[model samples]
Target: MIKVPIIKLRQNMIKKLTTFALILLVVSVTALPALGEDDENNFIALDHGYTVDYYKSYGAPAIQASITGDPEFERGETADLKIKIANVGVISGFKRLNANQKRINDSIEETIALKEMGEEEEATTAKDIEATLQSETKYIEVESTGNFQNVEELETGHTAPLSYTIKVDGNIPAGNYELLLPVTYQYQANVRTVTADAINLGITDVDYSREYKTKTEVLKIPLSIKSEPKFEVTNVSGSLIQGESKVVNITYKNTRETMAKDAFARIIVMSPLSTEKSTVRLGDIGPGEEKTASFEIKAAQDATVKKYGINSEIKYLDDDKNTKFSESMKVNLPLEATEEKFSVTGIAILLIIVIALYQIVNVHRKRNHNNENVSGDENEY
Candidate 1:
C-alpha cells in the first residue's frame, strides 16, 4: 500500500471519537431511570415494564399504530394497518422469604362492599379495589419516551383502555413502514408492611416494578352511523277568550342514537281563522329523550267557527344536516257553542240619545225656514 497520509489519519480519528462520544451520551440518557427523584414511595423509568398490572380492564393499555406512504393518497383509495396490544396482566400476587432463603408466594384476597352505592360510583370503587390489590407496586414514578402526545399517569387498576384509527393517505405505496414512538408514564406506589399477626420486630420492604416499552399496532376500521327522530303534541288543549291568549304544547323526541342540537319546533295553523302562529326553539335534546316547548297563541276576535287544524314540525340537526319531523292535530274551538253577552240597557240608552238629538235638529231647521220666508214677504210689501 502507498504511504498513509498523516492528515487523513488524524481526520478519521477525530470523526471516530466524535461519533463514539454521541453514542455514549445517548446510552447514558436512555439507560438512566425516569425523571423525578426516586424515594421510598416513587419509582420511574422507561423501556421497561411498570409495576402496575395493566390488564385489569378490557379497554386499558391503549396502543395505536399508523402507516403513511409517499406521493399522497388518492380519492376512494385506502391503505390499512392492523393494531394490537397485550391484554394480559398479573391481577395480584404476594410472596414471602424465610430465614433459610426459602421463598413462598400467595395471592392476596379481600372483599369490600358498600351497599346502596350509585352505579357509576360503584364502578369507580371497583377500580380502587384493584389498585389496592397491587400493594407491592405502590411506588410512584414518571418517565417519557415521546410515543404519546403527552405525559399519562396510570394508577393501579384505575385506567381504562383506548383505541383509535388512522386513515392512510389514499395514494401511499402498498408497503411496510415503521416510526419511532416515544411514550411516558407517571405512577405512584404503596406497599404493605407488617401485619397485626406478626410477632417479630422485623420489617419487610416492598418494591414497585420499572416502566415498560412496547410497539403499538394500528388497524383500519370504517365508521358506521344511523339516526331516528320522533315528534308528538301532548296537552294540546287550550282555554282562552276568542280574542285572547291560548297555550299550545309540543313534545320533541330524539329517537336517534345521536344528540339533536339546535332543535326547533314550528307550529303552523292550517285553519285560516285569525290564527296564533308560533315558532319555538327547544335547543338540544339528548338521544332517546323528549323535550317540550310551550307557546302562547292569541286568536283574532273574528276567528272562524269551524275546528282548526294545528300542525307542527320538530326541526333538528343530524350528521347529514337539517331535518324536520312533523305532527298535526285538529282542535275544536266551536264559536257557536259558546255565546258572548252585552248589556241591553246600554244599547237602549245609546239609541234613545241618538233619536232625541235628531228630533231637536229637525224642529230647529223648520223654524229657521219659516223666519226666512216672512222676511222676504215683508220686503216685497
Candidate 2:
C-alpha cells in the first residue's frame, strides 16, 4: 500500500473556505473593475507613468483549488478530473500613505488620486495564472499532457476549472489521495496616479501606474479510491509447447476487501494462441482468497518461441446480482519451441530398414561378379 501524504489543513484556510458566501458578496459588489479601456487612449505609451502614492493596500491574491465534483473513484478507472480554483482574498484593509483630507478635500487632484487608489485595490485579483498539477504516488498517474495550465485572469471569488486526465492503479488500496496544484500568478502590488502624463499623451485619463508582484501557492486536492474487490494473477502453471494443446492452470487472488460472488475467469486469446474453453467457473472469491482455474489453450505450430501475454478478466455478480467485469489482467505464458522425438520401437524399425536395403545391394553385387568371372573362364578355354 502506497502511503498517502498526510495533510494538515491550516486553521486559517478552513475559515476562509467557509466564508465563500461573504467572499462572493464582496467580489460582486467591490471587485475591482479592469483598469484600462478597450482603445489606445487609456495607455500612456511612455517609459513610465507619474506616481501619487496616495494609499497602499495590504492584502494579496489568495488561491484555493478543489475537485469540482465527487472525488471518490473506483480503481482501474480513467477520468478527467476537473479542478476549480477561486480567489477568495479580500483587500484586508488599506493605509493612507500621504492623504491630508483637510487640505486636499474636494480638489481635482484628490479625485484623481482616489481614482488611482481604485486601481491599487486590485491586489486581490490574480492574473496570468499558471497551475501545474502533480501526483506523488505511483498508484495514481497524470496521463494527459500540458499538466501546466494557463489562465489569463481570475478575479477574487471567481472560479475557474482545470481539466486533467488521470489513471488509477487497479491494485491501489482504498484511501484518500492528494494531488498537488502549484499555482503561480502576478497580482497588482502597487498603483499610483499617472494623470500628469495623460495630458501629454493626448489621452483622456491615462489613469494609474500599476506594479505587479508574482506569488506561488500550492493547493491540495483530495481524491478517494473506493474500496472494491480487486484480483490479480498470482501464479501460472503448465508450459505451452508449439503445435500442442495443454491445460494451463492460472490462480487468481482477490487482494481487496469486497467479496466477488459467482466469479468466473475469462481469457481472451488472439492469433498464434487459441483456447477451446476461455472461461472457467470459480464459485466465489472472498478477501485474500485464491481461486485457481484451468484453461485448455493451444499454441499454433508456427507460434514464436517467446513469452506470450494473454489478456484475462473476471466476470461476477455484484451486490445487486448485476453482472460486472473486472479490469483486464495479463497471463504470461511461455511457448516452448517444438522439438522432434522418437520412441524406441520406431528407432529400431528405421535401423532395420536401412540394414536390409544394404544387404540386398551387397548380394546383387556378389552375383554380378560371379557371372562376370564365368564369362572370363569360357573365353580363356
Best by lDDT: 2
Q: Rate the local accuracy (lDDT) of all candidates.
A: 0.42, 0.82
- Per-residue lDDT of model 2, residues 221-292, tens digit only: 999997778889999999899999999999999988888999999999998999888999999899999999
**If scored against the real structure, what TM-score would every candidate get?**
0.29, 0.60
Candidate 2 achieves a global lDDT of: 0.82
Q: Give the total clashing residue pairs for model 2.
A: 0
Model 2 pairs whose backbones collide: none
Model 2: residue 148 alpha-carbon error in angstroms: 2.2
For each of the candidates, the C-alpha root-mean-square deviation to the true structure, in angstroms, is: 21.3, 20.1
* Total clashing pairs for each candidate: 28, 0
Estimate, for each residue in 185-223, the C-alpha lDDT of model 1 and write its tens digit: 322222222232221211123232232233222333222
The alpha-carbon deviation from the true structure for residue 357 of candidate 1, after best TM-score superposition, in angstroms, is: 24
